[model samples]
Target: MRTKVAIIGAGPSGLLLGQLLHTFGVDNIILERQTPDYVLGRIRAGLLEEGTVSLLDQVGAGARLHQEGLVHHGVELAFGGARHRIDMHAATGKTVTIYGQTEVTLDLMNARKAAGLTSVYSASDVKPHDFDTDHPRVTYVKDGVSHEIACDFIAGCDGFHGVSRASVPASAITSYERVYPFGWLGILSETPPVSPELIYNNHERGFALCTMRSSHRSRYYVQCPLDDHVDQWSDDRFWDELKRRLDQKAADELVTGPSIEKSIAPLRSFVAEPMRFGRMFLAGDASHIVPPTGAKGLNLAASDVHYLSQALREYYDEKSSAGLDGYSARALARVWKAVRFSWWMTSMLHKFPDEGEFAARIQIAELDYLVSSKAASTSLSENYVGLPF
Candidate 1:
């Protein structure tokens, strides 16, 4: 088989990139190791930056998002037995939408199907070959039969652990990472959210976040030891721990229900440099990962796709390699800023076991200054709402 671009992954990054490229009149095919049902079953971040929403709109996948996604203009910081609001819309004239990543993927999947785009699911041993040469190709085994695809380019949106980045020699790439000492124990419940906007809480006990997938489905999380397991946490214990970390008012208004989903996610900041390797380019998790404290993971992926899609479009439309040559440097600039923001947020909100009381006081002081100062709040707002793509 042959295509202009072979996208290795059916996650949002690859799917969005494929859609964008198709709209640009560039043909592409997607290969995934997992089935479509498995892809939709993975739970992920629900916050959408304005830039991410715009990308979906560009691909004609924003109709359902606009109909169902909740729009928030501000977020609250809880500390010192109180809650303070950061007016993101007031500060930056931008708002974030509460749309689940799964929904975004489903929307993109539906759009792609409607357009008759090619996507190979449940194809095992999928690999990109000869991406370093002028003629690149991808190979996979489907139904125990081997197949190969000759393509002009390859997109490695498979993620940090996928074959795309793994295909690059160790000497050709550099990685930076910081694995945090804690993890978030989160749960989803069929109940109204405690607040209209998301609340990020910093407590002496640990950090907690109250976010939602929709008006009626609340998603909440509390910091825990890195080694903690989901089996150790029951619905009652989770809710009690969450209440202890929240302000009195939020605790009073909090509605608890049987958790439909529960999991513990370790926090980490990871980045692999030089996103481009010859004819193959990496986008999204394949290139970078951020702690979820700032809600930047999926948005970062979208930004990578934004830069990548543009670069690919320019390559085909204007017959220029300038954009392709600059894709890595351009994407990395934004990737690092988000990494910094996510690290900052994790530092400010999470309790480090070794840091002790001084660090706690410092965090309180930082949060106080952040909410009290207009400049600091604006800086947070701008980063949270997302920087321009």
Candidate 2:
């Protein structure tokens, strides 16, 4: 079988690319390692930058998002027994919404299917063919038999663990990486939010965050040892720690009883240079990984797709490869900005026990100054809310 484009991984990047290609009257197919239900049900990053929301609307996938998303004008930076708001609207003249990634994915899926496109799920062991040639293909096993789908090119949106990157020679890809000393163990509770805006707190005890996933659901996180396990903490202990770190004001705040789900996320910064090789190109987490402090993950992926989609559209319609040729370095420009912003935010907050008392005090002092100075707070808010796609 063959297609104009063969995309790996049905995550946002891959799915959105397929939808964009269809908009340009190009035919494409997407292969995902996860089941459709799983991909649709996976609850992850929800904050969509204004640019990303605009892309969704242009691609015909914003019906559910525009209706269900909680639009936020700013986030609260809490430290030193006080809470400060970094007004995003005032800083960047932009807005971000508290819509989960799952909502966006479902919306994309519905729009794609309505436009007569289907994604094959549970497709494991995807192999990119002819990396050095202009025409390449993706071969994978769907159910019981192996199949090869030839295509003009392949988009490796399979994320960090996917096989497309592995297909490139080790010598050709230069990777830069740094692993942090701590991780965020977050929980999703079936309760109402305690605050109007997202709260990010840094205390000697730990780094904690309070935010809402939806009207009826609250999302919370706290710093833990990099190797800490979720089983180490109980439901009661979770709420207690959150309240202590957050300094809950109301008695009925965060009605935490059942611990629905918990996850540990390691902090890291990863980037692979030259995201393209012959017929295969990388997009999304497949090329870079940023700590979630800046809330840039989903937006970055969407931005990469927006560029890639534009490039592919130019190549197919105008018979010009100028846009396609500029994909990597162009995407890298924004990627590194986000990488730096995420690292900076992570450093500005998160207390490090290994650094001793002096270092911890210095971190607090810096946070104090950052929030105290309007210019500094503006920089933080601009970086946190992000720029155009």
Best by TM-score: 1
lDDT of 2 by residue, 1-389 (tens): 88988999898889888998898988999999889898877667878888888888988999888788899999988887778778878878888899888888888888888998868889877799996886788888977789899899899999998898988999999999989999998898888877878988887788888888898888888888987788888878787877778754522366775867788889899999888898788999999999888899889998899889899999999999998899998999999999999998888679776688887788788888877788987888787777766
Q: How good is model 2 by TM-score?
A: 0.97
175 Cα displacement, candidate 1 (Å)? 0.4
Per-residue lDDT tens digits for candidate 1, residues 1-389, read 99999999999999999999999999999999999999999999999999999999999999999999999999999999999999999999999999999999999999999999999999999989988899999999999999999999999999888999999999999999999999999999999999999999999899999999999999999999999999999999999999999999999999999999999999999999899999999999998989999999999999999998999899999999999999999999999999999999999998999998999999999999999999999999999999999
Task: Point out the worst 10-residue segment of candidate 1 by lDDT.
Answer: 126-135
User: In candidate 1, residue 3 scores what lDDT?
Assistant: 96
Model 1 reaches what TM-score against the true structure? Answer: 0.99
After the best TM-score superposition of candidate 1, give how far the Cα of residue 302 lies from its true spot, in angstroms.
0.6
Best by lDDT: 1
The residue-level lDDT of candidate 1 at 289 comes to: 88
Each prediction's whole-model lDDT (CA): 0.96, 0.86
lDDT, candidate 2, equals 0.86
Clash-forming residue pairs, model 2: 46-100
User: Candidate 2: lDDT of 351?
Assistant: 78
